[model samples]
Target: FVSMACSSSSFPLMVSISGVRGIACRSITPELIVKYVAAFAYLQITRHQKDLPITEKPEIVLLRDSRVSGEWIERISAGVLQSMGANVLSCGIQPTPTAQLLALQRSNAVGALVITSSHNPKEWNGLKFIDSDGLFLSPESCDVLFQMVNNSAYQYPSFEQRGSFVDFADAAQIHIDTCTSLSYIDLEATKKRNFKVVLDSVNGAGGPIMKSLLETLGCKVIGLNLEPTGVFAHTPEPVPENLGQLCSAVVEHSADFGIAVDPDVDRCVLIDETGKPLGEEYTLALAVKFYLSATEKRGPICKNLSSSRVCDDIAKEYNCISYNTPVGEIHVAKKMVELNAIIGGEGNGGVMLPDVHIGRDALVAATLIVQLLSGFEGTISEYKKSLPQYQIVKLKAPIGNMVPELILADMKKKWEGKEGVTLTEGDGLRIDTSDYWVHMRKSNTEPIIRVIGEHQSEEEARKVCEQFMSEIQNWKAETSE
Candidate 1:
């Protein structure tokens, strides 16, 4: 069934909870979506209350991006939720964060089901479970959902017992209003300055929200794939290569800055005012600067190991503790809880501002960026100028022979005497040096081993990776020889 996800292969359709992905029918069918959603609803309902309220059926927040398959999944999943005696509130084409925020705001509900693959391709689709507190499902809850999915316990009730449906259009508006008002930038000033900004939303949930938020923020925004059509113009990852259009737009229009959000508006990468693709790593860093500037509160900060080291500097500068996790929003969120992080997220432009919400919100990302630039009294480039410059070189290796356990063991053994620094084991291996750090990870979503290194010079960073790869290759050679 995994072959079905490959473009060149045709295989029988099936669903297992690595979470659903790929084309709507060939990979993720309506039946699959319905069953998964129903199973999740069952799990949430049972876990929340020991005694089920007969009249007050458990309510669930249903949300989706602009993917056409989202329509199919939403309708089928809603039917399944209602069938499972759960009240359904549909928030159409909203960012994942909006749904999470709404679910927490409307705390009467059990949890939220977001129909998005996050940064996945146009053909791909997924369901991200958000807890009552507006974060990814806890491990205990996820396990329950997995059990329900596997046991085939998601059954619909009789006609009369079937749960009712209600239109929840205001959920999106409410989220938007909250974000626009929270640490919000002055739209009037942005407009008065005639700020020209280029926005590339990758035709996902970010489209509608970015357009609305930017317009309201008073920027003459030029948007690529402005419609929430889910027809992704390129890879929806918001990486540097996919951001050429945005960079070009900024330069061509002489826009003040360029913003790019992933498929769902949970992450926002940026381009400087000069059309320079600043890369996604800076999004979290920039957001931290803005957030702390807006508020004097300081505590622990959390991020994945693969995130930029700029966070380390920010945390140290602010006299706050910084913790690194493996990856995934759930992992970061967990660390935030432990560290009581004031802010947290990944290097992929997903800034988790706990004050606004625990999850990533690209709308919040946009508003903060706008407000930061407006308050700075200078351009984005000028603001970025104050930060240290480092060139990051990225390379990928196959994960087949490069087992994570083996890699971590070898790394620990090798780096034992080099330099003593903090280390953690969840994703792969990360070692902080006096001047630079290298994070080697096996991508959870992709079948590749990514080696990322950052240093003062490109040559230095690239050489470090090459040397590490050489050592790895040597180790493999010796192991086999």
Candidate 2:
């Protein structure tokens, strides 16, 4: 019912402490990057001083995806941090997770800046901040830092106190080695299968590293868009519809499967052996299946509330407990740490293994999934059929004029007492039934409300979503009058 439905042309540059994303020189400019980076550096130095060594300024790591605009953002960011008397460890183009891992490697690192717009288009670029512990800043951290930026309370040191810059080139190798070294991965079994995989990197930062990773896993790798040229061949996001080339390449080569990574390489999507594009939601589900099968000790699993319920089903198969957090990588990762979870990530093709690294690593997800396929007796399609089947339908409407609380109240009044249905809210309104579920909430990154439904069939999921859409429209019309 909300009428301000923004199209791609009208979508605002998403800005937050997590990152500031926009088309270069439009919503995001060099000056804005400088101010934001300076503010972030200010907070890192002030709040994270507990781990500071004596007689030195705090160090921050800087890296970027393969976007053309990222080069300028990285240079501007490094300059701002340097101006603030903070040392910068400049890592050239790399995955967002690589930057996080490199930050953890440095004993004196206070934080890191990753210049990327993630899955956004070529013109979009932004800065993602990572804390000393190699995790994205929590919402609470973002709130505090945004306040400082808005108030212009950031610290700027004089010329005598400027910080120095150092280049670190071993980040990609380190990330690769660490993933292959995880105890949960079965290298011998994976190698024995000698799987042939088609990899689509979308001409982003993932190209070289993903090829290296696939080869290391002993698979015959067919590369598409392998160059880190920053010129996107298709939409940068690894969604099913955008991955026609990957699916076709898999069929043409008769590869065992196809793999795709987002621009930053933090998220991964897969295509089955049948040249079918598997939904991004299945990435974590498949990972969870492999992880629980590999280890006898099933501790805890974690995911965002909006993620597919297949994760919970997989955890149950291993007699493990699964926890849900709000829809954010930080929320899921933080909860995983707090609960000592074995693995956790969002449904958008991100898989976070605390054993390998705290952040989402597409490389790690691909490794585990290969291990799973290598050990299984059937094709990826057969393996997918073995799991509980569910189809999800997702739609978004603008958050115009209506208060979210009032809308949620109306929903509760309408459905709370329905037979065999239950309602709960942590990040949004979710109604769970015996065979179907629906979740409606505001998007964290965009100015819209998303309604997602999961049912046994596509038709069923669509029906549920359409039902809600009609109700919301009716409610909006009434409120306007």
Candidate 3:
């Protein structure tokens, strides 16, 4: 909640637990990439050397999405790691989840670096750092890396001591094989359904692999923006507003459903058989319902604070525990590991199945959705109707020199002891009521406060979110005065 204004020189370069992102060539330059990569490489080398033999070099897996600048970032990152005496396994044009899986599968790998801005526009690119556990770096680890980057406290090896690089071409196939082999995926049954699906990958890294997965499962795939040309046909985010084409395609093609994934393929959003978006929040909720119903495994479910309450309702139906963490994949993943949760993810169409890997993966979510619908006795829309339904409205407010913590403090006081009101202030201020819940938190990657509210009705959700936004604006005006 600390107010840190961006200087003109670094207007949009965002460094956070989510990783560093900004408009390419402007804020996120080659020099910035080199510094961050070198810092990350140095941190990994130091961390691994503490437990392994000094003679052995740390292996780092490098992957990138299909952004035009991704190749440039990859080359610079690989060279930086190699220069620091870390061997690089370069997996070209793969999704973030694929790189995470590779990092986990490679016994010798010490860490990983993915060059992608995720769902950001094509002009934007950034870096996501993964630890040896195939998870995003924890907040503490990121703090240390940022400190090193700020201080330029990394080392370079001698010419002869520099490490080697290898071009790895098996990442996609390996990821596909692992996903197709999951016990939750009834391959033969899914194939027998012979579902027709429309897939829009936004010409990012998921196109070829997602198409391949559906075809392997015997699905007739209608592909759009599948060329990985780094030129997005529309806004890259797979939200309802950005997915009109996918929705229309689903209805136009008489498909069973439509699927859209972000640039790095970690988020999955779906359109129903009738060409209606199922809402990004339902992605995780549907996955939770399917996992709990389809398997004998009964454990806790974890999601971010901003996720839908329907997930909790689904867990309650199964007599399972549900935990809510701060808004980040690492937090949810760590909580899942601690609780041995069956599944966890963010509400932004990210689904993390521990059985697959502890990362939000579109591939995993898509597979689960396909299987869930294939086994259901009705259409995709009907199946959605069967699940617990909720409406969520998400809006952003500009900070404008107003401190987020101060705004949250006022909100906490305003609702501290109201009837059935509960306030959570760990990551941000979240006010929970019997009917709906509203969360206001600072954006990790943008200079704004995200105000999210969910209720059984869409109008109520929008009203609650707008109320908070109006209050924030009032506070900003007062601050200006």
How many residue pairs clash in all the candidates, one count each? 1, 0, 0
**Order by lDDT, highest first:** 3, 2, 1
TM-score of each: 0.90, 0.94, 0.97
lDDT of 3 by residue, 1-481 (tens): 2223354544577778889988888888899999999999999988876766667778999989999988788888889999988889998999999988988878778889999989888998989999988899998898889889889998887898788999988888998889889877888998999999999999999999999998888799999999888899899988889999999999999999999999899999989999999999999988999999999989889999999998999999999988999988888988988998889999999999988799999999988888888798789889888888899999998766789989899989989989889899888899999999999999887778999999999999999999999999999999989
Error of 2 at 110 (Å): 0.8
Give the alpha carbon lDDT tens digit for every residue of 1-481 in model 1. Answer: 0111223234223222234555567667776786788788877776764444555667789989888788888888888888887788887888888888887877458888888877766777878788778888865566667677768876666688677788877866687688777644556665676668888888888777777778887888888877888888888888887788888888998889888888778889889988887867778888888777778888999988888788778788888878888777778888898878898888878888777788878887777878777777788888887876676777777554456568768987878667556555666787778666787766655555678888878799899888777766676677666
Q: Which ten residues in a row have the lowest lDDT in candidate 3?
A: 1-10
What digit string (tens of lDDT, one per residue) describes model 2 on residues 112-221? 99999898788878778898889998877887776777688887888998999999888889998988988878788889999999999999999999999888899999
Clash-forming residue pairs, model 2? none
Ranking by TM-score: 3, 2, 1
Scored by lDDT, the top model is 3
Task: Give the top-scoring candidate (TM-score).
Answer: 3
Which parts of model 1 have CA positions greater than 4 angstroms off? Answer: 1-19, 49-55, 153-159, 183-192, 400-402, 420-422, 469-481
RMSD in order of candidates: 3.6, 2.9, 1.6
**TM-score of candidate 1 to 2 decimals:** 0.90
